[model samples]
Target: MATTGITPSQDDRSVAELVRQFSEQTSHLIRDEMRLAQAEMSRKAKHAGAGMGLFGGAGLLAFFGVGALVTCAIAALSLELEVWAAALIVAGALFLLAGVVAMLGRGQTKQASPKPERTVENVKRDVGELKERHR
Candidate 1:
């Protein structure tokens, strides 16, 4: 007979012992896999959190940039008039823009209906057709 590398002691073990060893190995493998998954997710979460912080920093910088641009506009206008007058003009223009945008947003909101009109109509039509077919 060809030697399949089974030692005498290993070959002497009962079927139940072999099954128990297999179960133990399977449990260990599952535990290792779970640990690996946990590590991978933790690493990914750390990267995502860092990315979000960077995005927030970028947003803050952009806001400051806009503020700087607005100040520059006011300074340019001040070249022709007083500083206070230039500031007031810019403030008024910004307020006017805000009002216009608010009005447009309100109009769009008013146009949006809570009910799904098209879907409701289609369902009603389908029900009516079913009723006609049954009759």
Candidate 2:
């Protein structure tokens, strides 16, 4: 009879080696995926920070805008009313503008909250399953 030299022990060892290699490859892939997620998260955080900064600038501009409006109001009232009454009216209008801006800023901040990433969640699930299977 013709002889084939494959042994059962050798075949089992080869299978184990293949599984170990596959596990290592999967782990490396997960690491790569995690790195990508972190990069994306950092980019998003930067963008959010920039947006917040812009909002702050806008808030500052709004303050100045309120000042301009008050100045205009005072100028208008100074034509007919007493100086103190004109200043009081301008102050009231500035307060109202400040309240509206505050509300708008609050809404924008609420909208800026970070959302969960699906890729990170999937990677976590995959790692958990792999660990459970190896055990």
Candidate 3:
């Protein structure tokens, strides 16, 4: 029988050394998992921010567009009605415009996900894998 110095039997390694190796590896694993989670969360946050920005833009555009439309209508009415009456109509139109914008913005906001669903699912999978491995 021949034994090579390059290969050591499990018994050759000290308990303390094994413990240190296990701890080091475990720490590395945890850090890697944390990095994965952070990356996933960053991606999700970007999407959420973009969605919110879209909603804001939609609201702003709708507000201004409707305001302009109302002003045009009021100007058109000014030819036949008193300026004060046209202004009152414009005010009422403004309220209706705001309601329309609110509805549109609500739809845009509804499309946004406040939760990091992918990260949550990944974390759950990691936890389940770790549990199985530990057991």
For candidate 3, write residues 50-79 as lDDT tens digits: 999999999999999977887888889999
For model 1, residues 7-120, the per-residue Cα lDDT tens digits are 998699899999999999999999999999999999999999999999999999999998998899899999999999999999999899999999999999999999999999
Q: How close is candidate 1 to the true structure, as a TM-score?
A: 0.56
| Worst window of 10 by summed lDDT in candidate 1 | 1-10
Sort the candidates on TM-score, descending order. Answer: 2, 1, 3
- lDDT agreement of model 1 with the native: 0.97
User: What's the count of clashing pairs in each model shown?
Assistant: 0, 0, 0
Superposition error at 120 for model 1 (Å)? 16
TM-score of 3: 0.53
Give the per-residue Cα lDDT of candidate 3 at 124.
99
Best by TM-score: 2
TM-score of candidate 2 to 2 decimals: 0.56
Instruction: For each candidate in turn, give its C-alpha RMSD to the true structure in angstroms.
Output: 7.6, 10.6, 9.7
Instruction: Output the lDDT of residue 110, model 2.
Output: 88
lDDT value for model 3: 0.92
Kindly report which residue pairs in candidate 2 clash with one another.
none
Model 2, 1-135: lDDT tens per residue? Answer: 765697766666776789999999999999999999999999999999999999999999999997787788898998899988999888897789889999999999987748566777999999999999999
